[model samples]
Target chain A: MRKDRVLNMLDNAEDNIVERLSVPALTDNEKERLLKMSMSKLEGMSMNINAEEEVRGVDVYRRPRWHRFVSVAAAIALVSGAVGTGFLLKRSGKKPEDSFHAVVSPEQTTELTTADTVSTDVTTELATENTVIPGTSETTADYQAIAVDLMKAMNAAELASSGMLNTDANSPLASDSNYFKIVDGNIKGFDFSTMENVRNFLTDNFSGKFYEQHSYFIEGSDPFFKEGPDGLYARYTGRGSIYGWDKYEPEIISSSEDSFVARAEYEIAGTTFQVDMTIVKSEDKWRVDSATSTLSDPDANNTNNSNPYVSLCKSKIEDKWNELTNESDNVSLDFVFNDLDGDGSPEFFLMYGNGEYNYQIDAYTYKDGALKAIGNLPGSHTSFAVDTSSRKLVLIHAHMGAGDYSWYTMENDALKVIKNEEFEYQEWGSNEATSRQDINYLSKGCIYKIGDGTVSYTQPECPINEIPRSNEINSFTLDIVDQLYASAAE
Target chain B: MTGNEYRRLYAESPEKAYAALFKVYCDYVYAIVYNKLNRVAQREDIDECVSDIFADIFFSYKRNGEDYADLKAYIGTIAKRHAINSYRSLKLRSERFSGDSDEEFASFADDTDIETNSDDRETRSILISKINELGEPDSTIILQKYYYDRSSGEIAEMMSMKASAVRMRAARALEKLKKSLAAAGIML
Candidate 1:
């Protein structure tokens, strides 16, 4: 073994032994004895007048009730003022993008000036007045500025962490709100006091969206939020906590007078996803109307939309097909470019759609000299989009009252099913509701990716394991119905 | 209480200051002794070692002016050195007396001495002294990373640095430690 390894092992062994061996807590008598002995020793070192009276060990951290009240009130005032200002700014023709920029500016200001002033003041104070040392910064104004800036920064940070700041370039239309209301709950009304509250709120609200999205894509329910036989909770019971601070790199995709689309990408562990948030002027404050997440393509240059490389890909596919088939009637091919393998070169995707609904998907890559067909996903009558963040090809298939979406990727010259989920809403509850319930229906069956090219099929159970299974499929059914409604509306 | 608070009270009301300091750091001091002398010393021995550590702290404070930027670190140094010294003496005494009986010597010979001997103690002490010589954050980093086994993320949190930066610092500190150890003829 290496010397350092041996040493660490020995040290760890010693630590383990020490940990295992019970060390009794110091008894009251022992503590008093030790305190008295230590005090006497301290006194003997330098005889202070009235040493006996001074070392009484009284509680030193006592404060009047008014002081606590004032502190709490001040905290509340600061938070309320900042939030109110944020809302006001949004109302007064200032975008959240502006607020983000403003939050960043103060941090830079504090960083530049805080150090010099604080250090100089500390040096001067330490050299002169030895007793009255401020615990934080040098001056009250500096402290206040820092605290206020911190509050604003923290507000942004908290929002970003809660996935509220996670938005993409896509917006859900007003007509499709009910289908997505469970997925993207109105962030306007939620509280952001503590990290836990933020996490719980997201977990509670987004749990349905997560289960539905996964089930639709045939991905398993998140282990953290899953309660039991029922897949997700009816209401957000507000239980458990999620770890990590949310950090995002945001880009303003587009903006107008009443609404703006913003894309914010965030990374957790190593996986990255982009959230597209659509903010609309609701009453006075700009509220998040809808949000959706997709895989963030780090390599894809979205800025330069007219990519020459993509153009080259289109030319190659069209030229090759024209040479072979020489038929273009009633055939329309749409192109979407992305880098699936992280090789810096863009993967070319062509959707060969007939004038009707049937579309055949083919993926191509440029290697050697000519264009090469990497793989093809035999298409059905479906709508499709690429989740650039996760590098997965998403296919949405809706027929009659059933909707199924599958996430596919090319691996080893073959199509790999990452996740496939389908849901069927079997009721005309919108018309034949005795309880005036529109779109209320029964959702049945779910399937998710269990492994590479493997999927597990099961019915989603109620997330809350406490109560006996009652109205178990109600939430999932609503989500499925919502999905169908969204598909139809789109 | 903060380091400044301790320093102020140490200069002014020495007894109350010591009381406050002891109240906060007694467990910390005891933990060092307990770890260093575990399985080798009795409970009484650990208690005595802790008391000795406190005496050393008191004397050091009295000798030096009130400019302790990190009181925990200062106390850690004293406690570690004193406890290690106590453990070394106990180990050496056991080794010396083992030769008194042939059977006892045979049993002792079979059992490998994992605890530090006299030579190991000198090297360990020298290594610690060199770490202290490294000063401030480097010394603290080495102790926290290697001795306390704190993660880079945790160390980063404490130091208000990025985890990558903490890892870089730990690497640099380990390199410096190796060089210093080689110079002291420890070479580990």
Candidate 2:
């Protein structure tokens, strides 16, 4: 057997064995160096999360809810500026019917207005007493529009709070935007020049318990923001980069004279979620009271059960199990599914052994709804080895201090022999043996005979023989396969 | 750190909590990644993998918002998976540019092998028991020099001894290990 092969096995030994072998303590300087490196990478990930458009190929997940809230709070600090006022006024001026029609498709309009029609009976009666028309299509459209506006305003607040809107140098909030400041290449503080602007922004967009919870505007009440002599300032809270919702599409689900519940669909990190926002009229102005989100697509959240790839694997395993069981009464079959080629698809590895030292393996992958054989290894004196980094499968057969090594790789859905070598070992008297060969493989006509503490290359007396590929599945029972599958899944 | 302490610290200060978490578990994470990728990857790759693992753990904790009863186990699982991914990526890239012929196959073989065997667990257990019997600096020397593949100077720094002394102890320890394994009817 190869010495490196034995060492690799020991590298992945049991947890107790590993712990015993890896006992050298790291110096304090080493720990500090590693910590600094980790912190830098994490900071980079955080920046990518907060970016408006993810860096070209970077993979980012959704930002946590708490960070979004803090971003909105920061945006509120700039409410006194012209950018905030212009955005609010531009949004408020659009007629409810016009805004509703512009924002949603005709099909969505019908669905949302249908829910309003059933719930607006009481509103119709109240409208009849006044000069307003009762149960008119315009009235129903108005109700849906109001709910849509509240959702839009909340989303706008999050965008502005995220610092995406005022990034340009000419923007009005750029120079005086003191709510968040970068120091030493980090966003470290939250300090506003005016507290009244934040209070007004919060009061206009949020109300009731939701507003109370976000009442950092209340002097000396919340620990996050403080009203000191040098404007309203907050200590650095150590939160990562701030991000806003990528998109929000709201449709009124139900409506009444006083309230409307809107379902808003939004996308973050390429995944969609639906948030049900409850909007209520307080002091004659619509405001968002609360909202809760659920994943929009069932399959996106439960891939293991619905994934077609998993189904294909399970089906093929069952077929192979039946075929093996029909051929023999006592057989030992075991298998594992791994993405050996880093292709994001697991390849099936089926092993048939005699419950002793000899074992054979056959690898298969699913393509066009059929199992395609990718690789295989015949039975050997020891189990086959997989080099995860190089994606090579090695088989070694050893007996009487002689061994043959065959290295295989998947090429065009077939295992191709990449390298082959044979070696012989001899021990002299006094238990002395030659140092293991550190040189590269010799030409095909040469063989390595290690002895007397020296490595010498000599022509082989006979031609070297290659190990034959075994692509056919050896018949075996299913009991061991089931256990192996369960273990692999875990 | 206990789950409660981490939660409390996270609430009070996330930066402080991250520092505490890294300080407590960096070595364990480093060892796991280093052992898996040492032969195939460069030192920089190993360092980057360790950092990526911690970043993943921190974000996962933030996203799940659940209290981990066993924080070490959670960290260990993430570390192992990340190391494997790093190893695969590095290996694939190297294969694309490698220019070795059959004459270099033996050296190539020495650099690539990552096999694990449940069948060998019992034998490994016996071998580890023998190594532990060699005692203190000797045991550490053998493991650090052979298993970890650390240089004698590096092992000396960790054990606070001279490099020459570390090499001498390692040689003697290997002899004792061989004799001990022979007594158990095993030969190297």
Candidate 3:
């Protein structure tokens, strides 16, 4: 932001504060009323309303909402681990249903782990896992300095007011920019792919502004400093709707204050997202970066079940010609589904986008499938993902206009992620999980609903055979993958 | 910090949680209710909802203990949603008594005279100001979506957008008002 404009916005904002807000002291009657309104539901909820009956009985039972409202002196009582569980969830009056429950089930999940780094928080607790920043070895005074530098890189209003944000009318690259990238470095493990094949598969299957995107404008210190005083970039770009496929850009802020992090309010898609960026210095320069932003594929915890269909598939593929569109000057999307020949199957894939978030994808499946991506406005075809689960073909893409992931499964004839659950990639580093010593996260992951379009999440308890194993990240997600792999090996 | 220590504290006194919750969320709650429920003449109700959410949060902590994950995220998510739910749900329920219940609720957008042919952004800001006046979830969801540009699906998961009917109702209420109010040449 121009220094003058920024200062002006701030001044205007300050002046408007009073007219916009009026603080009133709570009266006796008002306090009583507030107390009742507050506890009516909480009194019943203090329990894991969604937890299993047996689990709820295990001491984390429902408590009266009024009980917790004591003064701060009383608040110290809640410091206990066991007692704290009650506040996690409120119970429901309805009788037991299926018994499974989850809170804040985001549509996207990311995983990042070095091919050499081994397991993760969800997997084993690496004996030498460095979760904290290695450089913070000094005392509190050192951290204070680091925090101060972070504040220097702050520039949120500028990003929020950028032409792209104001409207496509001003976005220079609105209709033409298409490039797929995964930026990762300073912070380890924060990496993902910009798969054109996956997005193309989605475009073919959807109609009416085929994809979606959830964006954010964060002002934080750069984790990897290149020179001078590091500044936080107006991180922009879009992510696809496939729960975890979302992209964000880095818009550099001008400052030398070191690393001070402040999240601008970014509410796109149906959910609001706040990116937490950590700052660091390298090569005598200050820069704002995310711990989980990576372009390279880390060691993949993958399992592909393939077979003899290769011979026939290869022959059929050799028999057909592939079509490619260079229509997008900077972006080109091409894909040949291994399920070639319209068969209901998925195989090999390839493609590309114009830039940080301009993309196109086309998937031809012998598996009896086809895809179509319709772009309506700016940020055009950022990036996307595709997978066929539960007989229904699921597609994920990002919208240029809205900064949120759009989920679509072929319905009738049009592809639509008309539900909020369909959006993904709420925030940068949302999936970026790092150890205290490591500069970057070991991996990233997102959780989403698969059945009945309802949220049902599973943490990869046993991320892989190499993980050292800990109960921390595991406690957050279900390890269905680990279970499956274990059973399959058996 | 130990589990037993925390439990003993809560057992010794329950008000501890309420006080704690209040401090942690005072700014946020005040911002939401004051902004969204502004038209709600019952200042008592607005105040009640704020304190209630905190009290409820404290009790919830005492009831359902969580040792891991960011505590602020956990509580904020629940509190914000509850506050909004109460405002909207309460308003809807009160309307069931349509006959003589002193229906003084006026259109928040009644004051706006935005141009009908205004561009997307012009229409967008008008919607934002009106929603902001209504406060909380209405403003939260609208600004988060239209202003920030989030999808409805993402919103649904973060919040209990609940039945499509409920969401449709909120959307209809918002969209209709934005559309109609934009035509208010004088206000625009």
Best by DockQ: 2
For every candidate, C-alpha RMSD to the true structure in Å: 32.5, 25.1, 28.8
TM-scores, all models, native as reference: 0.21, 0.36, 0.25
In terms of TM-score, the best-performing candidate is 2
To one decimal, what is the Cα RMSD in angstroms of model 1 from the true structure? 32.5
DockQ of 1: 0.03
| Rank order (by lDDT, best first) | 2, 1, 3
List model 3 lDDT by residue over B72-99, tens digit each.
Answer: 4334434444444444434433433345
List ranges where model 2 is wrong by over 4 Å: A1-9, A52-490, B11-15, B62-65, B100-115, B162-164
Q: Any idea what lDDT model 3 has?
A: 0.29
Tens digits of per-residue lDDT, candidate 1, A1-490, equal 2222212422312222333221223544555676666656556644531242123101000101011111221222222221111111122233334323322234433442343354344345443533321342233232222222222332332333222331211221133210101222222234433334445544333333332322211122221122213112111111111111132223446555455555655433233445565544434334444445443553331333344444455465455344322322222333444455656565566654322112345667666655567755433334444443464456544322233446666566444567755432221111121112111111111111111111111111111101111111111111221221122222
Please list the C-alpha lDDT of all candidates, in the order they appear. 0.40, 0.47, 0.29
Give DockQ per model, in order. 0.03, 0.14, 0.06
Q: Compose the digit string of candidate 2's lDDT tens values, residues A1-490.
A: 2242223446655545655554654666766787777777767765664241222101011111112122222222222222221111112223333323322345544654454343344345434544322433335455545555555455434322322222111122233343232111111111223456456666876887556535533433223333444444332221111112322234667766667777766443233456677877779877778765544663453336544555655565566444533432222344455444556555666654322112345678767867777754434232244333453444443322323355655667755667755432221000111122222111111011111111111111111121101011111212222322232233
Better model by lDDT: candidate 2 vs candidate 3: 2
Q: Which candidate leads in lDDT?
A: 2
- Cα displacement (angstroms), candidate 1, residue A466, comes to 73
